[model samples]
Target: MRLAFIGLFFLCTTIYAKQPAVTPHGVETPGVQTLPYVIDGNVKVFHLIAEPVEKVIYNGKINLLEEFVKKNNRYSGPTMKLPVEIQKIDGWGYNGNIPGPTIIVNQGDFVRFHVSNHLPEPTTVHWHGMIVPNDQDGTGGTADPVIMPGKTAVYEFQIVNEPGTYMYHSGFNDTKQALKGLDGFLLVLPKDGVDLASSDFAIMLQDWAIPEGSEQIKYLSMDRNWFTYNGLAAPNFPVLVVDEGERVRIRFGNLGLMSHPIHLHGYSFKITGTEGGPIQESAQWPAATVVIAPGETRDIEFIANNPGLWRLHCHVLHHILNDTSYFAQHQKNGIFPEGGLWTYLYVKPAKDQMTRASE
Candidate 1:
């Protein structure tokens, strides 16, 4: 008993002795600053600095316009041997993020799009499913002229359709342009406003094929090696976070060659609408899975009642796996990896989880 007590005393002495003598780097002694000292004699100190934030303000006008440049973009992943260059890509969308940005506007606002062609060929931005004037239809050879290389043009149109999900993509070379990862989703809200939901998300799915050790995508190969949501495969994709008991609206769009049967593991949702318009409340239907075909878009809403990590992915087996060769290489050795058209839907306990994280 005495030895044990002596040992406890020594342990306490050692812990206290290891405490770091923290001092403020740019302030007076002990001025509201301290370092965290761990048992292994490690000290962690942090400095406080204020940084400026760039703010974008909107005021119900269609004055907002974005630039889209077509170029080659490099795509890489943990499964690939080297980064593959994707031809017919976007400078703003590919550089900033895949599938471009989420364009949100009121039902009656006038929106304009500034498009610039930088690729070897000509291209145009088609407001897919949008009822624009014939001149602003963006059909390249038909509705409008192609935005040639090093040339820029603008398409301005007023939103006349009902509030719902919509899609935008390259309409120049049809399959060739759209298949090169040139597509995005646009959201139109009711003029008054929408019901305050827990959160909202826009997910765009696409597929790509690139040969091993190659830089450019194989435009003709049907064996696509990479499937992505917003240009990121599983494990690399950001988690879709929401609070338990909160309602969520997920807008889905597919601009690839094939269709995708998207499945959500934990909850069923109502098909709220599509790119055409909002589905009437009486016409809405509940579904645990929905199929999005090429050039299609779907809007789904659900209450996150489950509090856990759930899987959201394409039901197609090959789409859920990264590459065909990778799958074959592993199948021969009995090793199948997880990642591809999959991501986690994280449901937290409370709304504070969202607020605390945003702050």
Candidate 2:
């Protein structure tokens, strides 16, 4: 009897020890924000307002040109004074933010959106890549009615599709309104409520055709000069921090005019999913860069085995810098300073190493 009791104790201890640590399941949009929702009965309710907002692409505190000049004294050029406002634009956004706030939900969940139009013109919210009723599609032509300025529209739908990355943008005058910044990410998690990744991030890519020395966004122009991730250009975007050996997932959405080949340094990842749905394991392939075209979303996952700061940026050379003409004039040997659609992934040491270091 004593032996049996000891054996049972050992089994229970082993079982409890093998249990994995509980990590919260949710998506994080660095440099952007998330929309809050309230639960009414079985439905989740979200409120959004489309309005004209002044967006700051760069805080202008980090003068890359000045740094370059200080590093290379041989180059003689005019250095921009510190604390100059880099790029600010008058654009349209939902809930007071360009690219708006991310809306996260689960498969099989019923959701309602109360979208109010505060802009000077009418608009509608179209759920990109979502399967919903015809009338609730927000097409704004013969289908859903447009939400006129100063009016509100209600859209309710049950998510019947698989878990994946999706987006929402303006339906009426889409090219003009969306280009001015009326778009956002819509992420749907699994219904089982099990998110395997230790860190899940959502990033939205956008570009603007703003001329130098101007704060207005030229929505009709196709020549984009400013590029951003989550409404922020590089050097201003927040770092994505995670522990070494942890699984990391990043969802990329592009509503811009051009495609961006987003690349990650120091590690290779698998294209696990897209805006449509998760790719089968057999269909998944290893890639260091993934091209996200307009109206598309790609989800990539990797294990953070290396403990270091890794660069994650758009490979399009022109898209990596802000104020093209300004940087072009100060270019050294044809190399420009980094600025747009760029950020770092900071991987900390493993938990065991941290514990040992403390001792």
Candidate 3:
């Protein structure tokens, strides 16, 4: 289907600040908030911190991958960003940045994840896909506790798992953080590697609350229906780039508190896997889109069969628009409009893309 974002929308505010400093040991210590911001140029910002440092590393960025949230804990660094921050479900500091980042890895290769948080509250990062040990699930009761703020947690594991679409996000209080935009796509390519498809596509699903007036963020608490990609809302959402007839595989997931019936336009794909884990030949399903629940993920296979900037979004319309404010209502209805700095896809046709001269 060809989705058009042809509607008017008011603007919202973008909040930027320096992250606060933690205690000597990465536990909660008394100090002023010293945040960071992206001023100009292209910046690769990890939404979470994965490990800890003795003093300060990379402006609070943990360099090593660890499995624990404290220094000299279990796992170490690798490095990362906390995907979510608590804001009143009503408004301000609810969700994280859009399409946080594209975490690309190769099969058999390893990535050490250091998921740390600086918020007042506690949380953890759960690798939605991959063979994460029980200790790394990030649940207080099930695995780990809500990692205390000012702490670095490490989760080191291999991508020995097959190559497929997967996800990652805050596993503690998952619903709130997800709906507020704390999620991302994990692309685990094959070791030998297959061919086809454009460079590579990693798409994520998430929603957020972008308030209109103040510089603070706002997210929903419960009873939410808003939807988006990498935190982008209607019209402003990023356009996926592709070449017609190319074998395109989309790595998709839902970090929202609510489940999403991810629908794609134009063609269908093979339902490869769920939660980034491999889908055995017997378990594989085929469809144009798949249904992904919170903390769940899917890998879809399809041809760029039909090209023309086809729109990819959640089937839920309300979640795509969220009324008129975009950031209003704490995104209880949807996420922030996608325009600002987070436009994911911008496909420019290289062949047969331009309009031919009419007779």
Candidate 1 pairs with clashing backbones:
85-215
- Better lDDT candidate (1, 3): 1
The candidate 2 region of ten consecutive residues with least summed lDDT is 63-72
lDDT by residue for model 1 (192-270), tens? 6644454777778887775554434566788887777766655455667677877777778888777889999888899
Q: Model 1 RMSD to the real structure?
A: 18.3
Local distance difference test, each candidate: 0.63, 0.85, 0.48
Rank by lDDT, descending?
A: 2, 1, 3
lDDT tens digits, residue span 1-359, model 3: 12332222111111211322211121110111112233223332233552211211012122111211134432344422222221122221212334445565668765566566755567777776567677866665577667787876666666666776666666766555544445556666666554344434555555544443322334453434334444433333334555555555565666655666767766666876676466776877667657877677776766565544344556554454432343443443433332211222223344655532111
TM-score of each: 0.71, 0.87, 0.59
List where candidate 2 sits over 4 angstroms from the true fold: 1-25, 62-84, 328-335, 351-359
RMSD after CA superposition, every candidate: 18.3, 5.1, 19.1
- Kindly report which residue stretches of model 3 are placed more than 4 angstroms away from their true locations once superposed: 1-47, 50-96, 140-142, 208-226, 280-286, 324-359
